[model samples]
Target: MKVLLLICVLALTACTKESEELRMRVQQSIPVPATMSQVLNRGILYPTAGIQVTGVVRVVQLSSGKQLQIDSFSITPGPDLKVYLSQNALPGNHLNLGNLISNNGHQAYNIPANTNLSAYNYVLIHCQQFNHLFSYGKLQ
Candidate 1:
């Protein structure tokens, strides 16, 4: 009985640590009255799920760096998917925001401080498993 309790405690601690790594640390949200661009994603290498990959991609400039917010966002979930801000709307030339948080709804990802927002004009949903671009939004 004691051994079982010890195992449970260790498992819980490991899970807690993993969850902490996934959280984004953000400070200060400097909002622009309106989003600079709104976009829609269409599946690449195939037709995206008909649900309409849609959302507003806004920039919330922060003290540490820029936070790219996906507001009113929705998409079909895929394996090993991730978010990115890119110039060419392709997979490689992008600032990887991290693993995607959801198939729909609002979320925020950190944009590196070195990134030039003017050059990175689009946000992409990319599948790391298949090496495909799931969808994209062209920043207006």
Candidate 2:
């Protein structure tokens, strides 16, 4: 029994170490037209329990449409992470912007032209597989 417990502990530690080293880096700089040089709303991201998140999130007006931009962003690596534009800080009643591109970097998600920013004003990083809220930022 002692040997089995030791094995379990070792396995858990190995898994944690592996996850820490596996960071997916991404960069997506969406170009805004020179004429449309406006940031309609912006906010700072805050981490949730057991997570570390740092970033400036903003809504930029574009010639084509609006975009949710994350700059100088980094987050604790997790499986099945997704980007969401939510009505609340929590996950319910949200727009699934799609899978998070990376654990760290500048990334952008296009906001549908029809989306009402006043209603869905909170940006969230969620773990869809586990239904976990990793971080959130409310646009003001």
Candidate 3:
């Protein structure tokens, strides 16, 4: 039993290390676009995965208007993930941006043209199928 448990622990550690290495490689490869010039707000996403989630959430003013950008973003991948602009830390009273496109790297979600930007203060990465919050960054 002790030997088996030790083996499992070692295997899990190896897997975690490999995942971290892969995440770093992907993040390093994403180039920030020059068109992302008008930064309206910024926040640092915090992990709710019980593992490290690192990224910057930016509200940028594009020619089309305001949109949210997740830059150099990474988090543990899970199923049925979605993004939200919320008034609270939890998922309720939220504006569902749509399904998350990737578990790591840069992505953007559009804010409705009529949205009152000041009303929502959090950018949430949530697991809709499980109703779980994966992480969040407070909009500033």
Candidate 4:
């Protein structure tokens, strides 16, 4: 009876450890900002398998009327993942905003606004498919 109980305890301990490791795998990809009030004052919903993500890239306008360029890039789901932006809609000089691949959802490239809008008027969100598994972002 003593030996049987010891075996059972060992089995339970091993299962617990495995469970913990699995939980850590599906973690939030994005970092939560300290001052979410300013950016996410409207509140944002982040899709979670078992992780938390907060914040998105925003275009901030400086006092000057010169569009500042911001760029960010991330690897896609597959090697061949590609992104295309609206040439006509985006600011003329501010091309090459960044690339969003199929695997990862939208990543932000913050550009300082040069117009009176004080924010980005037009944003082109690109993904391989509309209903992709990793489609996530803050609700405007």
Judging by TM-score against the true structure, name the best candidate: 2
Q: Rate the local accuracy (lDDT) of all candidates.
A: 0.67, 0.85, 0.84, 0.34
List model 3 lDDT by residue over 24-109, tens digit each.
Answer: 98677533433546998889999874756889998888887678889898888878899999998888989998888788878887
**Cα-based lDDT at residue 124, candidate 1:** 79
By lDDT, highest first, what's the ranking? 2, 3, 1, 4
What does candidate 4's lDDT look like per residue over 1-140, in tens digits? 99999999998888434566565753343222222223321223233253333333343333332222212322224333222222323233223334442333444333324333324333333333442322133223
Tell me the number of clashing residue pairs for each predicted model: 0, 0, 0, 1
Off by over 4 Å in 3: 1-34
Q: What is the TM-score of each candidate against the true structure?
A: 0.62, 0.75, 0.73, 0.25
Report clash pairs, candidate 1.
none
- Whichever of 1 and 3 has more TM-score, that candidate is 3
Q: Any idea what lDDT model 3 has?
A: 0.84
Error of 2 at 30 (Å): 8.3
Of the pair 2 and 3, which is ahead by lDDT? 2
Model 4: number of backbone collisions:
1
